[model samples]
Target chain A: MTVYSNCHVITFNYRQSGIMERIYLDNNATTIVDPAVRDTMEPFYCHMYGNPNSLHLFGIEVRPYLHQAMEQLYSGIGASDADDIIINSCATEGNNTVILGFYFNLLKDTRKKHIITTQLEHPCVRESCRFLERHGVKVTYLAPDRDGLITAKMVKDAITDQTALVSVMWANNETGIILPIEEISKVCKEQGVYLHSDAVQAIGKVKVDLQKVRVDFLTFSAHKFHGPKGVGGLYIRDGLNLPPLLHGGEQMGGHRAGTVNVAGTVAMGKAIELANASLDFENREVRRLRDKLEDALLKNADVLVVGKRELRTPNTLYVSIRGVEGESMIWDLNQNGIAASTGSACASESLEASPILTAIGADRELAHTGVRFSLSRFTTEKEIDITIEVANKAIERLRQLSTSY
Target chain B: MAKSDLIGGELWEQYSQRVADRMNNPRNFGELTESDAQKLGGRLVIADEGAESCGDTVRLFWIVDEKTNIIKKATFKSFGCGTAIAATDMMAEMCIGRTVDEAAKITNLEVEHALRDQEDVAAVPPQKMHCSVMAYEVIKRATSIYRNVDISTLAETDIVCECARVSLQTIEDAIRINDLKTVQEITDYTKAGAFCKSCIQPGGHEKRDIYIVDILARVRAEIERERNPHRTLSAEFAKLSVIKQFKAIESVLDEHIRPVLARDGGGIELEDIQPGENGIINVHIRYQGSCKGCAGNVAGTLSFVEQTLQKNLSENIRGVVV
Candidate 1:
């Protein structure tokens, strides 16, 4: 493995003969697995390969590591020992489980058969609500305000007696605008409704103290926070008694049934530990780099940043250049060894205007032009400088060719 | 930095070198000013078209030499993706020395082909194919402006698939040129019925004036007739008995007409068939379901049924609503 002192600058093996310097700014999509996390996971793969459920001495040796990892996970989010965090696949699975589990466990035959989610949610939550809608569940998709904010009052006004649960994302994946989850959680508690927050984008980037904010359920994926992909955690508030989404073995206390991904769980523990330690770096240096890039982009007359910087996750900068389409900008950036995104990578394949941008009342033309540049703790000032220069040149060339002017 | 050292990986290789070059530094970018046209002793024609799906717009500017009806210069401006820039730049270059009429004949396929570095490799991906189509559309728009005619008269063909901008003439030409057989083949070659599929056949999500299934059948029949040279449609229909003719007309109505009307909560039923004066065969029909007593049954629906029967069965057959 090649190591660079500056973690952001890496030599990527291009399809052609030579190597190219790769600068990653799409960390909100996924992050590179931290070296420490990788080192922690190495032993679990071959050496400590016993199933956590086995009764042999091999399983007995692995119990303490699993217990320590569990403690690390609970402490990362400030969840008390009373609550349960079921390790599962990515946050997409966790989101589906929570949203669907509510319907099957509590809301299916009840008079309260309604779900409330925002229009700006990740597709997992939005699609899960859509799946329930086919089964006679009435879903009210609340639209965000012009500033891309979903207020506590919006949730308060939208809740009906027939509302079974309110599922809101802690931070929007595209815009990175942090929602009022605390106030929304209080409202859900007051109304006696179950609340689930898909905190996949918020866990490592922002402060997520469950002791401070009382939410019934929260879900996060490890990949978004510099851990290996595939493994995620779903926090169930104590005594909730929700039925399992997968129904075979008696793993995760019969809440989730597959054999635990020991390596992935261990890596996730180290990733979260590193994330907590680097929270200050994320808020200061990463935010500074993101702001520097945003300032450079804002020098252009037609660039529109999605949300105010203060309200968004410090590492994120979502901007729309008036004339340049998102994919075109991404293409130009890719050619220059810079990595960025046009909203969620999952939905970018459809080439449709971003639903999050549209939900925030951006015009159709502006919505198609949104490019998100997300920073990570490893991103350096030199990478930011190079990105600013390359992005400026791309925007200028694309604008010169644009008919919008 | 070396050009080959770009970090796009496979996606960079997907685009032709010419496309990559033009996309990065388009030669025919920006519009020609009125003074620029005057210096060339020509008139300026500007036309723009927008893709509603992706919000990409392309505008073409041409300086036409009025005396010879030739294009003195052509340039373009695109508010779209990179492929749109490359496609429009290549289109503009192709139009520079040609006459306005000659430039109007330029197809999206030619523009797409002109950008390819290799013989058979596609210049752009399938999703970006519409960018080249957009370039072709702006040319028609510019031609219409230069000729002072309506844009619709320029193509002289119905747009069969609006999503992909595949015209009936384009589809028919593709079928003839490429020897395309099935609708799937047409979609693969020309991208008609590839998206939304409203124009593939009747009873789709949206109503279409003309369908690809009908075009395929008509063009295939034309090809068949050209090959055989002896089996004439009129002679074949003339040999059928009146009952056979009625059944043929009924089947044509069932296949072509009923499904479209059914979607609108209406239906049609054949009443009778009679030999009118000369070679004319008059087929009587009645409206059913929501179509009964509807004013459209006499006007639009009557002509539609007559046209369907005439096209499928025999040109001598006419429809009279009872």
Candidate 2:
């Protein structure tokens, strides 16, 4: 006889899989793990499951794979040296490491207690600054213009003698607005300040050459480009002595300390190799499909494509339909078996409007009405067409029912 | 082959087929015609409700038989997600054949129940559960309109936790009568804040009119005030540093002012603080969201902010619109 304590449980329908017709357009939230990446990771799970630090042949054999993954990732992102790459968890951990690293490193220095960042950063970076702000650090959040572009002049104007670091993203996760990192780097270099970019959304979609940009630090996650989850990389320029966030036995040259995620690195290596090979396709075919979807939706519905005037990632299309809300639009699209997202997935649950949308000077109603349809190499023309149709119908219905409309 | 089968199709298992069916062909859709309304004794009422978070709205139309005081027909137009449509459609269907008074008694839970094919399985996803609430509110407005009464005064009980159907009076009585201290105890007693947890704090999955923590704190403060009526609320708030003072004011605003502003798609942000005349602290704030450029900012809302701050924070503190 089975005895239970309480009967309170939330259960789902548990329908059979491989039976529904659904379109997944929310790629920025997380991409599906590539089959090639999965195949590359499968062998390590059983046969070659060895700790990279061990003295045996199993360890030595896996060590080469880890290095190869790092080499592939660094080369793909245009990092000059292999030692600069420090593998960690997702971009959240990488961002926290850089922020806390700088915050803790600058604790002794009385004069340099200031940090400059934009209002368009991911919550990981923005919340980290807020955490520092609560602990007596002065943070100046530079707001963006209407098009969601943060000028290098904005960064230059905000930087002062007391400023220790300037952290910004290469591309926004929500609006896909690309920042002028090279120009921002030039200003930071002139001001003698360290600059960090959360390049998670930019890694697979755009070309980021650190040699050309001259930024001190950059970060990217593996899963954004069809790799497995739980693995990311950070690049620190030479001679930057920032403290480590994690403390343990030597790992990644003591920059990030944890037992090696060998399988993750192997999958990431394969994923990045594929992503680099398909960069041209992403810039062309993926972009064309994204444009087609946006154009179709704009023609049929009254919606504003966010950051249309600025440089944006090829795979992202952020739109704000008049008289309808983002959550409802996404939900209606989901009913038609389409997957889209509103703002960042972490903050999606909360009813608060997207802070990024607000930061870009969107009116309150428009900020609450935006939906993001992020694509990947896996997204097809057929899916885009269906999404446009479903989205238009959903919007039309919602507008008819809406009090605002 | 179905189009989505090309992709793995594993995640679609979350929602039941009944939800898909209801979403595709919603029941009780569209509106009652003028002739149809005339046939029902010209007792027609139309009510529109909106969700601020997503800007989704629903317009409910009800045709009541004036002589019998019974609803002859009900229909709706929804500008929202599938859940809102299905919930509103089901609510309209539930309204038919019942008197306006009886139809007004139908709750959002009953609307949700009508949409679900199974008891355990939800008709809509948990996050979309609030969509059904729009349907429930529109019904109240429709009923009140048909009866020529105020909408706010219709809901006899003060509902606090919508998901659990717990009322404000029930929660207040639970705390005061049972001598409760913790939010968990209140949940165990009345099941308020048990389901969605939005009624418990500021940053929950859903927004609520009143929170359990606030209710508990107010009740506790009232009890304290009864014990010693001389002690002032937020007396030391003025003595804190500018940022700390901002933080305290921000909490008060988040707890009180922001919710009221956010309801109308408006918001407020603290811009600065400077010394005013004769030891008064002047807090400069900029209106955001719908509040920006609103004509009411000068005469109407500014007074609400000033009065609320003066009554709560301190007499010397003043709110200055920037």
- Best candidate (score: lDDT): 1
User: Model 2: residues >4 Å from true position, as ranges?
Assistant: A1-22, A344-347, A361-363, A392-405, B1-20, B39-41, B51-54, B116-129, B155-159, B162-165, B195-211, B221-322
| lDDT digits (tens) for residues A1-405 of candidate 2 | 111111111121111222255677888989999898999999898999989989999888898888888788878878777338788888999899889888778844577999999999999999999998898899999999988889999999998889989999999998888999989999999999999999999888888888788888888899999998999888888878667888997988888889989899889888988998888999999999999998888895567888863388999988888777665677667656778887522124344568888787566666667889999999989888878777888888767665566
DockQ of each model vs. true complex: 0.21, 0.15
lDDT tens digits, residue span B43-134, model 1: 99999887665577899999999999999999999987777788889999999999999999988779888987667776765545655768
- The TM-score between candidate 1 and the true structure equals 0.78
lDDT comparing candidate 2 with the true structure: 0.79
> Candidate 1: where is the Cα deviation over 4 Å?
A1-20, A344-347, B1-13, B162-191, B195-322
Whole-model Cα lDDT per candidate? 0.84, 0.79
Least accurate stretch of 10 residues (summed lDDT) in model 1 chain B?
B4-13
Q: Assess chain B of each prediction and give its TM-score.
A: 0.56, 0.60
Tens-place lDDT digits, model 2, residues B1-322: 3563354323224344555555557777777777888876757788877766545578888888788888888888876655666677788889899998888889988877776666766655444566577788888888777777888788756688876688888998998899999999999999787655678988776666788899999999888766654335445555778888888788878988999999999999988888787768898989999999999998899889877877667667788999
Candidate 1 chain A worst ten-residue window by lDDT: A1-10
